[model samples]
Target: MNHFFRYFVVGGFSLLVLSCGTAGDKAQAETVTERVENVKVSPLKTLQIDREINVSTTLEGYETVNIAPSVTGNIEHIYVEVGARVNAGDLLVRMDQNQLTTTKLTLANLSHDFERVKALSETGTVSQQAYDQAKLAYEQTRESVDFLSANTFVKAPIRGVISAKNYEDGELYSGTPILTLTQTHQLKALVSIPESYVPFIKAGMTLEVTSDIYPDVRFPALIEMVYPTIDASTHTFQAKLKIPNGDNRLRPGMYARTSIKVGEVNAIMVPYQAVLKLTGSNERYVFVVKNDSAKRVRISLGKRVDDMVEVFSEELAIGDQLVTVGQARLVEGVKLNIVK
Candidate 1:
């Protein structure tokens, strides 16, 4: 019995010693955590930083025109194909018009007869009634001749490359866009501005644009037009910026990002991570340290670019040191340890 008691007492003392060591360890951890939870804040600084806002957009043609058939006829020949570079009045397509040629020949004969009759009337060999009738016929026949010749030939309206051709040779084409030619020398960046910004948008202001297709390329643009009124449904005003695409790099239907200078002012801004998004959405909070205790400050946030966010609220003043590096682990009235 004495030996069993001795064994039991020794085991119990060992267990007690182990519990005490664990408790000491836990208490030390709690003390270290308390010290580290302390926070520090500095005054905010007012800096004159150039503000840049990024917008998503695409490049578009300044002017797009469809080459619809002005005269009715069957396609006899196609002089140009897609991507063919042509100047104004260059032949693009031709229509088969046997009847038109025949009509022209008939008109020519009538014109010659009418001229002879007019000459006879001047010589008093023909009656005035005959002369007047012959004169009218001659003018009418001349117009017919010109019309027929035009119907047989298809021509380019301006200097441009044929981007599209809808009709094939021997296909009947009438009043349909046989080809689409665009002068890509100039491009336009289209954008819609909110109603609040309409008054500030002025023509001749500069714009900068970029596109995903050409990541390294930036096109200098100018404000071309601002619509006079706002769209009722969208509550936005339409705006356009012109870009010189003489190199043909900026094509129609290309996605572009456009930036316009709206306003510039000095505002208080801090590191992006300093502003906290609580509840994961619209709620914004920032930790401001006062006397080693972190005060959770709810801030009204504005434009942000890269790692900095603009804090517009009056609660944050210039030269106020913000806890930028370590803010996520803090709560209201929590303490933080400033490592730096």
Candidate 2:
């Protein structure tokens, strides 16, 4: 009976030990099976990306004109000064009136003589040749008088600000420009874009320009012209942008930076943190979390704008969850616990 009792006790202890080992194995297996890494994920989205080129530039006047008298005379009256605004056909200066008065008197005498001779010719009292001579002289004198009168009042050719004024009242006009006018209602922005971007640049493309002078203002401009040829040395092409400055807020000499949208493409954009560079190869990749598993997808990178980067991959789809944070510790097919 003692031997039987001892054997029964040993079997019972062995059975208990075996049960404990089995339970421990099951727990270990469960722990391994349930292992997962917490990661922050963001859904990949489709974005319309505009490829752009940024260039520094300076603003210029839309149109510049020099105002000068067509005839030689002494300036009698000055109507504008530097920085004065004028419109087309507005009188800017007046020439001496003595020349105009003399021409008018001569023209009046010639007109009276021509009419008397014309009436005589109609009455058959004067020769046709004499009448022709009087008419020609009168026409010539009238033209000369009209020319003198028109030049007496120097007018603005364009609507703009008088940027320069050289002569004043009583100044002799020696065929020199009296004033310089620049159109400020519209401005021009000259930007040099890379030659590679020349093909994509077209007229009417929108440009966003910013200036240090107006820190809070972003001036909108349109691509007005694209030069036909590129600069051989710089490998760059020049593009002209028209900026509307009807308020005259933007000056011609102001320094500016321009952003031109050269082209556009549909791409998958993700946070900067999601893209990773491989340790050895030059390949870039991102982790896509699908069905509780991490998938490694190789991608081609395009333009980067701020914190977002454009990625192209055949395996990536819009709305797919991508591991943005905690992806460094992940491998392909690894289980994921998506967190915020």
Candidate 3:
């Protein structure tokens, strides 16, 4: 009878323990089901925004010329100084005239001999071979004289300001240029634009440029040229812009910022807070509520408007609920209790 009593007690205790364990597990399951993250969301919408391409570059001269003589000689005179403005056809420098005078005298003597040889050949007094030799000599001397005259007087090829003067008067002409002339009436800016913008850019389009030195000024510019091919390494193409600097206020090598308005674009814009950066990477993403669960979507970002930024993604669509608030506390596929 004692043995039976002990057995009954052991069986009862085992049943009680099992019953308590089952109830605890049920309570724990309920707690987990109630744990829903509270978040605020905004519906995605398309906004019309101005599409602009902005690039920074340096201003350069419209035309630059290095004035130097073709022949090596003593520089007899330098008519222009640094910062001097010159017009086309203006005499810039004069080389030594002694060589030119000697060549001209030789040419005169050759002309006389050639004329005498031609008359003798016609009269049968000289052979045809002698006449030919005389004619060749005269022609050669005349060409030499002409070349000397041109090189002796160096003239300005274009209207520009003398930016540099390398040699002084009576200096021997070496390989270096005598003067550096730059056209300052207009300026050009070469900017590298991404290949994607090539379709929108074309020759003769108008653009706007600004300089930090002239913060209040907006210089008008026109597209002069667009490179036909893109750089494979950089995935960009070059564009040339011509800016009118009639006042001569803008100088070469000045820092400039250029803006080109291709056209307007319809973009999906969301609150800036909705965008989040992936940890340890530059990739950006945003979360949206999908079937009461948080769904992470990767995005490419564009220009930022006031309190909002442009976002692009294949998974995003208009009227989708985007999480703007309480996103930091949620993870992928987490149940969300949306709040107003």
Candidate 4:
């Protein structure tokens, strides 16, 4: 009888322990069932947004010219130095004028001989061939003088500032330029655009440009040229923009950001916070509530306005609930407890 009581008590304790373990597990499971994440969702809506393209490029002078005399000669004097502002027709350099002076004296002597030859020919004392020879010699000498005079006086072809002085006074000018002139009052920038935008971009289209040096200023730019051919390697076309820098504040080689409005696009607009970037990649995604569960949708982003951004995705539709808040904690197909 004592042995039976011991066995029965031991068995009863074992049964109680199993029952308590089962009850504890049931309670834990119930608690886990109540732990759904609370999120706030906004219904996606379609809106018309301005589609803009942004590209970075370096600024350039409107006109950049390397000024050099046509004929090779000794540079007698340099009238301008680096940073000197010059106008059109202003003499910038003077080559050796010894050749010019000698040619001019020869022309003068030929003129007198030609006059005497003409007088003789009119009186039949000199032959017509003699008069023709004198005239040709005089004309040829005069042409040489004119050509020498032009090369001796090197003038600025455009109104601009001298950016470089490659030669000094009493230096022999070979093939290199004497000076580098650049028009800085107006600037230009070449931007490469994707071939897809060729149809939308046209000459005279206005764009907004900003430089890193002057961050707050927005200079107005106009599309001055559109290249006819697209680069086969890059699959992009080039566009030249004219930016007015009347104050001479902007300089060439400065970094610039250009923004152009291609047109309007219809896109699904969502709060900027709703988008999340995937770790270790440039891929972006968003979580939307579908039938009380979070659904992850990959999206391609477009232009962002104020607090909203444009997203493109075939998986998302108008009126779909997007989780703007509490998206970080959610995962694919996780149960959602949406709150206001």
Best-fitting candidate, scored by TM-score: 3
Q: Which stretches of model 1 miss by more than 4 angstroms?
A: 1-54, 124-132, 262-340
What TM-score, over all chains together, does every model reach? 0.61, 0.60, 0.70, 0.64
TM-score of 4: 0.64
In candidate 3, list every pair of residues with a backbone clash.
none
RMSD of each: 13.9, 20.6, 11.6, 13.5
Candidate 3 backbone clash number? 0
Question: Which regions of candidate 3 deviate over 4 angstroms?
Answer: 1-45, 113-143, 232-234, 268-270, 274-301, 311-340
In TM-score terms, candidate 3 sits at 0.70
- Per-residue lDDT of model 1, residues 218-255, tens digit only: 88889898889888976678787888887888888888
Please provide, for model 4 over 71-185, each residue's C-alpha lDDT reduced to its tens digit, 9 standing for 90 to 100: 8889989998899989999999899888888888899999999999998988999988898999999999988888887788978888889999998889999989989999988
Alpha-carbon local distance difference test for all models: 0.76, 0.85, 0.90, 0.89
lDDT score of residue 297 within candidate 1: 79
How well does candidate 3 score on lDDT at residue 200? 83
Worst 10 residues of 4 by lDDT: 27-36
Report the lDDT tens digits of candidate 2 across residue range 98-190.
Answer: 888998898899999999999999999999899999999999989988888778877888889989988878878898788889999999977
lDDT of 1: 0.76
Where model 4 places Cα greater than 4 Å from the true spot, the runs are: 1-47, 116-133, 265-340
Task: Tell me which of candidates 1 and 4 scores higher on lDDT.
Answer: 4
